[model samples]
Target: MKGWRAFLLRRLAGTAAVVLLLSIGVFGLLYLAPGSVQQTLLGIRPATAETIAAVQARYHLNDPVAVQYLRWLGGVLRGDLGTSIRTGVPVADMLGLRLPLTLALTGYGTLLAALAGVPLGVLGALRRGRAADRLVVTAGVVGLSAPPFAVGLLLLVVFALGLGWFPVYGAGEGLADQAWHLTLPAAALAVGAVGMLVRFSRAALVRELEQDYVVFARARGLAGPVVLGYALRNSLVPILTAAGLIVTGMLAGTVLVEVTFALPGLGSLLVESVTFKDVPVVQALALLLTLLIAAVNLLVDVGYSLVDPRVRLGGGPS
Candidate 1:
């Protein structure tokens, strides 16, 4: 218990440090990026000295980069993400509305991928060298080859435009409506992830099936399902790690998918923010994403202990 507590504390500290550095890096990059925030705010109006100074003064753009970062960090600690220059809306408020959509999209896609991929992978592994295995592998290859945007467009054409099964654009309101609207977008996001998980899970399970314990279990007259279950249980650590990575990658993947599906998610917001050089929004989004990835990684690490008794929180075999 003490070791586990210590491990968790260490992970929390590390995550904090990573977020701090990410904040600095994000702020610095935007600060150094071409064009000035003051100019962006000023728009096409003449860059009069008074107007420039007012913009700078209003947003504290005249502060040193280090000072600006500290100010931003202080605001973040207070649960304030500052106002978006492009929209005049509170960054937190904008994020509050959009973040859940993005999270839901990612979760939906991951769930779909896992549901389809895991079973298909298990079947492929169990039927290795058979025609079923070949078919599954071929389908996975095709899935991996297709980009999310391409897949999204294809779905939009087929189910959305052709069959008119799902809505074409916008995230619908309410739980049921949102799920219905998000289906095509989520499917597009899931295709590549499903392929990756299929390959990974199949490989993990195959390796587990080849281990001595699996053979011993089979020799002991255990039912086929029971043996397979034991192999899957042993293979879970790697599968869980792969799934965690998939989730993190999906966050970034949402950018392309969101644009294709026209969902008002953080990905679309990020695109608009960057286009307008909305520094506050960009900085906040970057930090938020980094924090999310860190959280996912920490969860995967903790999950290792649950899935594998040999894995110790202290980085040694139990």
Candidate 2:
């Protein structure tokens, strides 16, 4: 009980620190932009003093940058992310609608990668020098080397244009429709993820297969499948850790993939916000992304205990 309490407290502290850093970064980015807030708001080549004062008054831009930052931070803490400069809509609401699409795309892509990668990895490890192993290695290399947008375009050309099996762009009308449109993009994102997972899993399994415990299991009359399963299960801890990190990376990487596919997701919103200099929207999105990454790391740490009994037995702090 004490250990669990300590773990929770540590995670809370880390989260708080991350949130503080993110807030500071957001504030600094807004303040350090090339032009003043008034200049940015007016969209004019030359800023008259009268116009500048009027604009500053309109948006409370005349306040000290620190004061403005605190006001925004306070609003965020109160669950209000402020209004977008471009659309004049609440940033929180915009994110609320778009966040689900991004999550869905990432979740499906990760699932596909894991499903395809793990089995291929196990097969490659078990086959060692066979043709199948060579093919897996080559495929993994290609997946890793290819750019995601290029892969997405190629898939669109083949599946949507040439074969007419799927839509070329847009996330379609509903959730199910969106998923259908997401197929190509998700596969594109999954390519690199699967490649990395395959290589990691295969190497880990190979190392585990050579361990003394694996040999002992084999000597104890365990069949090939049983011994392999035991070894693979033990080796999965590191793979899970790697997968967690990969998921976090995918959260960021999905921006390009989403854009390529024209999906109405957080990534697309972020791009639009940056282009328009929608300060509140951009800050909220960045802070949310950081929180997501931190949350995933915490989940993976907890998963370590679930995967290995030694971890739950107070082996050491993760």
Candidate 3:
């Protein structure tokens, strides 16, 4: 218990440090960008000295980068993500409105990948060198090669436009409707991850099956299901790692999928915010994403110990 707690604390500290460094790096890039914040905010209008000064005062554009970052960080700690320069809306509020949809989409996609990938992977491994294995491998290749945007567009054409099955646009209201609306978009985000997971899980399971322990277990007259279960349990670490990576990739891929599907999620918000030079929104979103990835990694690390008793987080088993 003590070692596990220490391990978790260390991971948390490291995550904080990484988030700080990345935040600074991104802030520096924004600071060094061509043109001033005032110009971006006041676009198309003549930039008089007085107007520029006012804008600078309003947003602290004259402050040093370190000072600006500290101020922003303080606001973030207080749950104030800053107000949007474009719409005067709070960045937190904007995020609050959009984040649920994004989370739903990401969760749905991840669920699909796991549900489809693990079984398929297990099948492929169990039937190695058979027609089923070949088919699974071939499908994985095709799925992996297809980009999320392309898959999204294809799904729209086939299901929404041609077959007239699902809705063509808009994130529907209520849980059931939202799930219905997000189905195609989630699938698009998940397809590549499913392929990767399939390949990874199959390989991991195959490796585990070849281990001496598995051979010994088989020789001990364990039932087939019991043997397979043991193998699966031993291979979970790699599968969990793959899941973490898939989640991160899905978060990044949301931008393209959201645009292709016209969903008003964080991905679309990010695109619009960048296009309009909405600095606060972009900064907040970027940091939020970093935190989310860090959280996922930490969870995966903790899961390592939970899923495999032989595994120790900070050191060899106590």
Query: What TM-score should be assigned to candidate 1?
Result: 0.94
lDDT of 2 by residue, 1-318 (tens): 888888788888988898888878877886786655565677855788888888778778878888888988899889888998777898888998999889988998999899999898999999888999999988888888888888998998899999999998888888788889888989998999888888989989999999999989888888999898888888888889769967997899888988988888998898888776678888899889988998899788888888777776233844
What tens-digit string does per-residue lDDT give for candidate 1 at 1-318?
A: 888789888888998888888778877777777887877787889999999999889888898989988888898899899999987999999999999999999999999999999899999999999999999999889988999899999999999999999999989999999999999999998999888888989999999999999899889999999999999999898889889988998899999889988899999999989877798899899988988898899889889989999999886887
Q: Could you give candidate 3's per-residue lDDT for residues 42-150 as a string of tens digits?
A: 8899899999999999988898888988998898888788998778899989999998899899999999999999999999999999999999988888889999999
Instruction: Report clash pairs, candidate 2.
Output: none
Candidate 1 overall Cα lDDT vs. reference? 0.90
Which pairs, if any, clash in model 1? Answer: none
RMSD of 2: 2.3
lDDT of 2: 0.86
Between candidates 2 and 3, name the one with more favorable lDDT. Answer: 3
Q: How do all the candidates rank in terms of lDDT, highest first?
A: 1, 3, 2
Best by the lDDT measure: 1
Best by TM-score: 1
